[model samples]
Target: MQKKLLFLCLFLFVEVITAQQDILSEQAEISVLTIGPGALLNDSFGHNAFRVKDPVKGIDLAFNYGVYDFETPNFYLKFAQGKLNYLIGLNYYEDFFEAYISQNRSIKEQVLNLSQIEKQKLFDYLLNNIKPENRRYLYDFFYDNCATKIKDVTNIALNNSIQFNDPRDFKPQTFRELIHSNLNRNSWGCFGIDLALGSVIDKKATPEEHMFLPKYIYRFFEVATIKNSNKPLIKKSNVLYEKIDAPVPSQFLTSPLFIFGILGGFILFITYTDFKKQKQSVWLDITLFSLTGIIGILILLLWFATDHKGTHQNYNLLWACALNILVIGQLLKQKTSTWFIKYLKFLVILLCLLTLHWIIGVQVFAIGLIPFLIALFIRYLFLIKYYSNRH
Candidate 1:
């Protein structure tokens, strides 16, 4: 009798362990966590990740797709060429929350309204994605970054059953405007973005395309539904952490507009002095041409030589003409070629065309360039008059 009782006890223990494993799928919960933007330029767009929890199975993990291995070969070069590979990272949910909390960023979670099978499917998909070979993927700012990865993976798990309905407070916006919303126009980061990215982002982004931003992901997911049942996709929503209110110190002096305005003023002052003296300042012309020419070269490389889709079909070339570099020789000569005057005339026309482009919405130039553009226009006019009189 004692032996038989011992056998029964062992059998029950084994059964309990098996039941716990089985209950993981039934009791599991999956959620999408959206983190608010941070103070740094890199984190300005915020982040998104998937959270899977199963207390019965002792599984609580967050899967993030924003992980980039800096140790990879030619990391900086690949990054500049837009060939950087981002990888999926898995971490304990507690650690993930703590990291963002330390940064003082807000965290919101949307518990998905999915069946047990669907939850298991999503969990399995994430696990598979984190595998060594499957983890790395090409990252695109607009279409396939961290935020859009979550949306895509979730849709895949649901077998395209998710219907992302438009949010009640939705507004039509261009990709560039969406980006600008997260950035202060006067900031250097904003200036660099406006300088590098081209007119491709100026077009209106569709409602679904807005999910490229994490905040928009949270908003649209709130209204999304399952195609099969027409039921809401989010079972519950929770704010895991609320960012503390902190006063950001104003950086007015270092802003793009202020600095550019000073430079523009100096250029105009030089031109005015040159006009009064009736003598061209060769050094000033050299500096202007060299800078614009270098910028034009870089823009051309980014457009044609790199994989950055947003840099294609750039129209900033009108003002930062590559021909400026080729014409530097003529500027240095005592008697320039007859074509030099024609080139100056052509540059003036290009500047005028740039203004037309801005007015007609062909492209939106940087606000910081306003002062510089005005300065360039006046200088070009002065140059045209100067050369014509000299001839």
Candidate 2:
């Protein structure tokens, strides 16, 4: 008995020690994820380079932030004239140079041989893609380079000049550090020849021509190629845009199509349908509204939440059209209330705003889902009460 008790005590003590050791080790090794300087620049410009928690080759496991998302990158510098000049290099360099060449191919070939060839190839590639018009800026980017002198640029510290920092990360971080690091890493350690030139040239051309020529040329080279940025997204988006030939909407147009279309149909249904005569059961009224509201809002919210920038799926439109038809059909025989109508009208306006934001190249996720949250809470509350009574 004594021996057994002693062994049992020893085992319990061992277990306690093991547990304590584990707790201590865990506390000691806990990784507080500080946003690394590397991650800041990559993620800010829509690139993802998260550390692997258990990296197979370099370190232990690292967190994986999937694919880098890069758009046009530019280095903004103050010119000799004190006006801000943005050098859009890499992706925009070829882009702007090409656009000018295509317009004056005969002249450009003579004036800028390398630029003309690059532009011709780019134009051919763009015209063959999904959206010829969206990529028009690409043409302008090409033009800008052809006009820009190759040696008038100088790099200014990002602090004194904050004209073109990603608005997303404008709120205080080591932006200057990131720029320095990126420039050094990408062989852009010295300011480019064109960037130097941009600082001196203050042409009296229209904003489009002036901006386009310099902005895209600088963006193309610096943003697209330097630092080995998010080429896949750019390639995919560019390819997708090239295939579709939609003209750029005016700045005033802001909403997504499905939001407005569905809301418009809902409003018309409420306006024209006579619900009193049909005597739609309270359950039916709630059911129709709840179902439509939840589904519609979910679709929009999901699109806002996860959909990538510069891509729109027409499935949302198709769903809206179908839902509108059904709602209209149902309302033809039933009547809706004035209060209910007003609520729906308000919903429509919000939905229109949502669409507009979407059309303007704003990320949906960045826009909070407060409206959707409220709609969901109200809907689920009604559903729970209605079901509870039936049961």
Candidate 3:
């Protein structure tokens, strides 16, 4: 008799919780929360979340699809291979607002114009989404990230009835360009992105596809409409907090371009000195070969071994030849085989082709690599001539 009572109480508790989720108060509201970009590279693209509140129901919660735990098994490895699973996160609305506000990020809310039944439907969807089995999802930066989740989840809740209209004065841009809009071109972060990602991101994004960014989600949703009723999707909008505009201390001297330029200058100086003295710097050659070879191998892994689509068709490998690693023994030798001279010439040819690829827009490389690439071209030419004369 006691066991039966305990089971009955548990059932009642679950039923009551379900009932509460099944019906929202007439004063219930749903909105999309857009948080502005933060200073860090990871937070540079901004964020998006759903806000649900009801005074009568005493319910106010936030749901976002951006949560990822660093403690997850093989986190870095999975991230590199694009196999990491991100999670849907839940928070009290007050807590959510406080967190971003504390970080000095702007927060804007767009009150969705939804019917009572539609509001309940969306609320139900959010509750269902937070279940342990349903919470985790594969994250794609440009296609299915936190911002795109707002658009996707809304469409799902509304039964795909939204007609997204382009914002006023909207201009189409490539995925890479869209990302660049939020980044400093001279930043090391930007340079790393350019080096790691390939030409796949250069294709122009569709109007709806631009919602991949949180700011664009706000812009597009500002004019979005319900297809059947022709009513605006958003009832109103409010800026809860505005980010303070402040100048970021210039890191230009420490930036990728400056550092790479300095290194490239040193390499050129060494090569020039070697040229005039009728000698070669074996140690320098060995170092260059090792660095380029390792970089090439890593690029190959990203392109072929990993699931990263953006790392495909990378032309940077033309300059960073993986074969250079295998040919390091030739660099140490006082005299090299005839084929080694041909190999050096082939490397020079690869550099020429890389230039052609750049000119023809086959792939856009890192702008910070301009001086470095030029130095590499000259160095390869000198290496070829030196090897030929020595043989």
- Compared with the true structure, model 1 gives a TM-score of 0.94
TM-score for candidate 2, residues paired by index = 0.21
lDDT of 2 by residue, 18-68 (tens): 455422211111111111112223222111111111122122211111211
TM-score of 3: 0.94
lDDT of 1 by residue, 324-368 (tens): 998898878887777888899999899999899889888888899
Q: Sorted on TM-score, highest at the top, how do the candidates line up?
A: 3, 1, 2
Cα-based RMSD of the predictions, in order?
Answer: 7.8, 24.6, 4.9
For each candidate, the alpha-carbon lDDT, in order, equals 0.88, 0.28, 0.88
Prediction-by-prediction clash tally: 0, 66, 0
Model 1 off-target regions past 4 Å? 1-23
Please give the distance, in angstroms, between residue 110's alpha carbon in candidate 1 and its true position after superposition.
Answer: 0.2
Q: Write candidate 3's Cα lDDT for 137-163 as tens digits.
A: 898888889999999999988999999
lDDT of 3 at 10: 38
What is residue 226's positional error in candidate 2, in angstroms? 12
